[model samples]
Target: MDGDIYKIVEQPLSPDAVAASVGDPAAGGVVIFSGIVRNEKDGRPVKYLEYEAHAAMAEAKMREIGAAVRQRWPSVKAVTMLHRIGRLEIGESSVLIAVSAAHRREAFEACQYAIDTLKQRVPVWKKEHFEDGEVWVGLQGG
Candidate 1:
C-alpha cells in the first residue's frame, strides 16, 4: 500500500534486494537495517530461530509504519520493509528495512522508526531454539 514494499516471506531475506526496492532518483541517501540472528542470546548458545506471523495483519502493520514514517518525515522518497519467517540459522537476516529520502538524516531517522515500530507493533513472533530447549520470545521469563 502507498507504493511501499512491505511483505512477509518464508525464504531467506536479501538486504541488497530490499535496499534496491527503495531506490529513487530524487533520493540523496538510503538507509537500511538488517536484524540478524546471533549465535547466542542472554549468554546462552542459540541453535536457530523460528519466526511466525499472522501474514495479513503483519503486512497491514508494516504498511501503517510506512505511512507513519512518511508523515513524520515528508522528505522520504520510498520505504521497504521485509521480514522472513520460518527457521533461520545463526547469522541469517530475520528482517530487513530500507528507506530512501532526499537527505541522509531523513533516511536514517525513518529507517530507525520503521524498525522500532515494527518490533513493537507487528504480530510477528520469534522462537529461540537453544541447545537444551526452545522458547517463544516475548513470553514471561522466556
Candidate 2:
C-alpha cells in the first residue's frame, strides 16, 4: 500500500518522522495531529492504552478515507495516516495524521476528516487500562 493512506506499525510514533515520511512539494501547508494517551479521561486516571485492529480491513478503510478526502477537497496534495498497535504508556501517541495541501484550511479539514472517519468506520479497537481495571472500547454490540 504505497499510495494508500493507512499504516500500522509496532514501533513508536513520532511527529517529525511522520512529517518526513509524507512530504509533498506541491503543498505549501502540512498539518499533523497526534492523539496521545492522556493521564485522565472522564476524570478517571488512565494508566495505559492497548490497541488492536483487523489489519486488512483497517488499512483498506484508511485508503478509502484518503481517496474520499482527495475527492472532497480538490486542493489536497497528499495524506498520511498511522495508527499504533500494542500497549502504550501514558503520553504515548495512539494516532497520527499528516496532510499536505495548497492552503491551511484544506490540510486542516482533511486531517480532521481522516481521523474522524477512522474512528467511526475503521475496525480498530482500543483497550484503556486504568488504575482499577481495563476496558475494551469500540465494540458496541447489538
Candidate 3:
C-alpha cells in the first residue's frame, strides 16, 4: 500500500526491478542495497540458503519500514523493499531495497535504515545450508 512496493515473493529477485520501482525524475539520487547469498559463513562453506516467512506479516513489517523511512526523511521520493523466499544459491540476491530522494544523503540514509530495520523487524527466517548441515538463523537460533 501507500504507493510503495513492499513484497515477499518466491520468484528470484531483481535488483534492477527494485531500482526501477523507485525511479523518479525529480529525485537527484537513488540508493540500492542488494543482499546476496554468500558462499561462506563463519569459515564454513555454504551451499545455499533457504528463506521462509510469514508472508503477510513480513510484507506488513516492510511497509512499516517504508513508512518510517518516508516519515524520517520527508524528501524521499520513493521506497521499495523486495525479498525473495525459497532456496537461493550463492551469488544470488535474496533481498533488494531501493530509495530515491531529492538528495544523495537522504536516499542513502533512508535506504540504509530500510534494510537495517527490515532485518531486525521482519518475520523472515533464513536457513543456511552448509556442506555438513543446515541451521536456522535468527535471534533465538543461528
Candidate 4:
C-alpha cells in the first residue's frame, strides 16, 4: 500500500485515469469500481449530494484497505482509490477504485472488498439533497 494511490479530491473523478494508475504490465485483469451519485435513494428523489471527509484520515484508511487487499490477494499487482469531496450532481462519480491482478477473479474480489471496507471505515460523510430536505449520512454499510 506504500505505493498505492489513495486520494481525496474536491474535483471530479476520472475512472479511466484511476484505472491507468493501477495498470500493471503483468496484470491479466483490471477492475474499476465507480460509485456514482444516483438520482434516488431509498425511494426518495435526490437532486444532488455533498461529500466531506477528514482528508488525512480518509486517505490513511484507504491506504489500509489497499494493504489489506494485497495481503488477502497475493496476486494483486496494483491498487488505486479516490474519493471526491464537495458538491456532486446526479450521475457524477463520487468514488473510484481500480485493482490490477493476475486473474480476473482476484481483481474482482479485491475491488469489491476494497469498496465495501471503504464504506465501512473511511472517514467520509455524505449529504443527500432532495426537494424536501437533506440528511447527512456516514459512510457505513446499511
TM-score of each model, in listed order: 0.96, 0.92, 0.95, 0.94
Candidate 4 global CA lDDT score: 0.94
At residue 140, what lDDT does model 2 achieve?
35
Off by over 4 Å in 1: none
Residue 40, candidate 3: alpha-carbon lDDT: 93
Please write out the lDDT profile of model 2 over residues 50-139, one tens digit for every residue: 999888888888889988989998888878889889999998998998988899999999899989998899888899888899888755
What's model 3's TM-score?
A: 0.95
Clashing pairs in 4: none
Q: Write the per-residue lDDT of candidate 1 for residues 1-142, one digit (tens) a residue.
A: 2568899999988888877888899999999999999999889999999999999999999999999999999999999999999999999999999999999999999999999999999999999999899999898574
Q: What would the C-alpha RMSD of candidate 1 be, to one decimal place? A: 1.2
| lDDT of every predicted structure (CA atoms) | 0.92, 0.85, 0.91, 0.94
Models sorted by lDDT, best on top = 4, 1, 3, 2
Tell me the lDDT of candidate 3.
Answer: 0.91
Candidate 3 colliding pairs: none
- Candidate 4 or 3, higher TM-score: 3
Candidate 3 on 29-113: residue-level lDDT in tens? 9999999999998789999999999999999999999888889999999998999999999999999999999999999999999
Return the TM-score for candidate 1, rounded to 2 decimals. 0.96
Q: What are the C-alpha RMSDs, in order, of all predicted structures?
A: 1.2, 2.0, 1.5, 2.3
- Point to the candidate with the largest TM-score: 1
Q: Which stretches of model 3 miss by more than 4 angstroms?
A: 139-142
| Superior candidate under lDDT, 1 versus 4 | 4
Q: Which sections of candidate 4 miss by over 4 Å?
A: 138-142
User: What's the true lDDT of residue 76 in model 2?
Assistant: 84
